[model samples]
Target: MTETFHEFVVQRSPALSRTAYLLTGDHQLAEDLVQTALARTYRHWRRIRDGDPEAYVRRVMYHQQVSWWRRRRLAERLEAEPTERAGGDHTDTTALRLTLTAALRHLTPRQRAVIVLRYYEDRTEAQVADLLGCSLGTVKRHAHDALRRLRAVAPDLLDATAERSTR
Candidate 1:
């Protein structure tokens, strides 16, 4: 039996939010992206009920984010106040995540999206190209450029082992 839109959202939102967060690199923007995507999905739910609604919503979010990025070429505003968190012992992981996030911010929106989809989402180049409505060559170029930029911006985060082996 097919699930209701609300049920589908409840089941899928957390994962979607994580993807959105990775794409936007800001909690608030991620929330907005998910919300906007869900809203659009809700509108088309009846028609898409029998199909892959989640994929539809994700595509909407991607396109919407890219549109927003194109329209606003201004620098992304960082959070003014850091939220308090329950202390954890994962300092190394936290530091690495922060470093990666900073490096991603240096990339263009399309490049960042390519990295997030290709690496974070673990999608193949063809899958990413399909999702982003771009060609395979475009995806490859973006991935190459994004990695090069990441290497320049945060060499430490790319591959410590490879760097060590070269040295």
Candidate 2:
């Protein structure tokens, strides 16, 4: 049986949101990514319903994000220190996530996408290349550059990972 577009969204939105968050690193951008992907997918719903619709949506998201990155050359931001939340549970995991998010911000959009796809999504290099519509060499280069930037920005986080791996 084929799934309706609305049903597919209800079932897949959470997973899509998580991936979008990892790809964009900001909640608003993640929501926009999901929204944009779904809009694009809906345009060909009948044709894609019986096929791999989720994959199609994801590909749209990746393309949209990369396009956003290209347009970002015209955007500017004013940085401000994040206000601390009072009386919240602050844990090592929370700290690590914050540091990782910060480190991810240092990478280019393609590099960030490569890191999220390769590590967070647990995709193989070839699969990531296919999804990003880039060559294997491009994926490898992005992954390499992303990791080097991460290590430079968050050495403690990388060292902690290494320590855990060796244990």
Each model's lDDT = 0.84, 0.83
Q: Mind giving the per-residue lDDT tens digits that candidate 2 earns over 83-126?
A: 35689658866766766777777777799889988998899999
Candidate 2: count the clashes. Answer: 0
Best by TM-score: 2
Candidate 1 lDDT over 1-167, as tens digits, reads 23588799899999999988888888899999999999888888889989998889988988888999889943486543334467854565675677777778788788988898888889999998999999999999999999998899888886753544677
- Which lDDT value does model 2 have at 125? 99
**Which pairs of residues collide in model 1?**
none
lDDT of 2 at 48: 90
Instruction: Give candidate 2 regions above 4 Å deviation.
Output: 1-3, 73-83, 163-167
Error of 2 at 89 (Å): 2.8
State the displacement of the C-alpha of residue 17, model 1, in Å, after optimal TM-score superposition: 0.7
